[model samples]
Target: MTRMLLSVERDAIATAARRVMARCDELARMSSSTEGIERVYLSPEHARVNRLAAEWMREAGMSTRQDAAGNQIGRLEGAFGPEAPALMMGSHLDTVPDAGRFDGIVGVLMALEVVRMLRVPTADGSFRSPFPFALEVIAFSDEEGTRFGKALLGSSAVAGTWDAEWWNLTDEEGNTLREAFREFGLDPGRVGEAARRPEELVGYLEAHIEQGPQLDERGESLAVVSSIASARRFQLIVEGEARHAGGTPYDRRRDALLGASEAALAVERICSAEHHMVGTVGQLEAYPGAVNIVPGEAHLSLDLRGEFDGTRDAVWQLLTTEIDAIMGRRGLRWKAREIHAAPAVFCAPLLQDVVRAGILSTLPEGVDDPATIFSRAGHDGMAIGAITDVGMLFLRNPDGISHHPDESVSSGDVARGIQALAEAVLQLNADR
Candidate 1:
């Protein structure tokens, strides 16, 4: 934790919610897809958003730059100047296909608003001249893994966990990440420059939508996150002979599609047997397109996540055992590859208290616990947690929808988020 000088007076911020919404809507149109939102890592849309965000950062009275990994970064130095550590803020800028306007975009805009509110000079009735620590906002380039099939790439670079092999990663268009980096005006060789030493940051705070129904169901506007879930993904291939539907006898047929179907059902069954865990077969495809032919092979993607790593891994073990049984009974050969694994990340207790205080400061009396939900979704914090403490404030989403066009957030909630986030920063700085 870091300490800062405390003061009483400050400039007021009134147009936060409107500004956040306007910025979000503006960024949504910068998407590469004309039909829907799709801003992948290092794409033309990525560059456009970074430029737009940098301009906004400048308007908010901060210095801005794009890191080697292409994350858009802005910093407001504290009284101690550039050598002083910072309290990191903001979230990823890239979005999923047909995405809504507010998912990651709102966090960035809210952060900028916080800066705008802070930038007012002492003549206008502001507090703590020169500040105590820098406020750094990072718009991580990719957290959705939409293009490279690997999430947290930009954050990992900053966390010093960049896997050297990722340079060769290819998108659906067969474009290698290295080539894309070059095209995006970044040098792959200098990516390590993006990493911040452990001491360079006081902590990382991310503001995002709940992405689930809990906050909405509770009728609350904001809540502190306890933890982000651990997740593991697998690519499975089930192989069986392709046989003509008319020629193959029912008893003799070894259908790969049937094996995949059973496997999917098994995932549902086993995951339901546990609490705080989910298994999803998001993609399922069978080979031999002709309707007359039995499937020669089937491919499926399995995403499993849980509140704890031990529990998630235990489920994985059980799933593998179940898959073996299914393959043995079906007379099909199967192979599986583990594509991604990220362990659970817990919010720091100190930061949680700070966030709770901020929430309580804004919410009316008789509100329930500030720490109301455990995030089952992954976030950029998972990577930043490698080097520093992390905390999160989740805004309400009425429909609990995300990664889709239907995603939404209320202006009132955004306003609360802005106030809470600013208060959290000030309180944390004053704590020590």
Candidate 2:
């Protein structure tokens, strides 16, 4: 059996993580969304973050460049020639409104660590070491899609699934995605060129915070993700007669708000029927929302997630069926729009095995045993897995809160994650 070649410096990893976390705070404050820190799509703040990432990549000895779609690529060449399949790793830089410090930044910075570790010279002035595959750290743009109501735009483009029609998608201010790209010094028409050939990539890996209570509850520093849950979203609009709240008798009035409430309740009931299924009414808007006016129309956004596609579809069907029945009986008009959907992703087993072995080997001798868990959240690794082999390692968050300012991970946990990642990468390239 080949021994793992783990040479990462503990101090170096910690310092790099702190540096990245600090940068995360800075970026968050700069992009504060209308909801709070809105670095949506090609916003000015998005451009600024991308430039900062490129500069950091260059400082770490990687040759960096931005693709037509504005996805930043930081390349670290291997001892082998360009023909060798490249080992790619990275996550998005964008975040939701009022997002926390870590979210996507941790994975990008950890990938940078791999480059930093390989570039440092040994005591004899020799290059540290080279792997068989070149490494590329990519900071994907617009993963949150908070601006255009579309998520995973950057990764979708790279995967050859970006729709050109969405280039004209405008924000609340009527600024088209293309216009924003131009303002940010990017060319929108060339997005398709960013699609990468599968042969060029051997595999991909991402290290991120658990963003949930799994690892924290389990007391594990590292979690090898086995799969990512699927997500489906629906938009429901209920229309009823407008009337004064006092003038319309409750028995005779067709209240859109009442219809919306019924639909929400139905969703909750459906989710309760299945294990691992979740349904949420994240956004609800009443037309002419007023203190004394009966709501004439109500719009609801339903977000559903589950471990399997069938479960997600079942929940969606249940909602639509209930909505139809309620609308017909209450004499209210209703319509449903399917917004976004992605199937559950099962990671490459080989890569996951490597990650598990690495964590088990490098963890402190007396620490708690590590656990492998399935991720309920979708990640860039989900898209990458569709194109090439992909694996993920999640660090334990103290409170399992992510995407908020309070999200945090302990320094020791971060260190363990770095060591495990380094070992995994080295093991993957042992023969080189």
User: What is the per-residue lDDT of model 2 for residues 62-146, given as tens digits with 9 covering 90 to 100?
Assistant: 7788887788898877667567778888888888877776888788887887677655454654332377678889999978888
TM-score of each: 0.94, 0.91
Top model number, lDDT:
1
lDDT of each: 0.86, 0.80
Error of 1 at 266 (Å): 0.8
- Clashing residue pair totals per candidate (backbone < 3 A): 0, 7
Residues 1-432 of candidate 1: C-alpha lDDT, one tens digit per residue: 221111222224346677788888889889888899999999999999999999988777788899989999998878777888888998999988888888788888888877776653545443221567788889999988889989999999999999999989999899999999999889999999999998999999999998999988888899999899999999999999899999999889999999999999999999999999999999999998679999989999999999999999999999999999998999999999999998999999878888887777676667766756789888999999999999999999987999889899988788878778888887787784
Q: Candidate 2: worst 10 consecutive residues by lDDT? A: 1-10
Candidate 1, clashing residue pairs? none
> Any residue pairs clashing in model 2, and if so which?
31-37, 32-36, 32-37, 32-38, 33-36, 33-37, 33-38
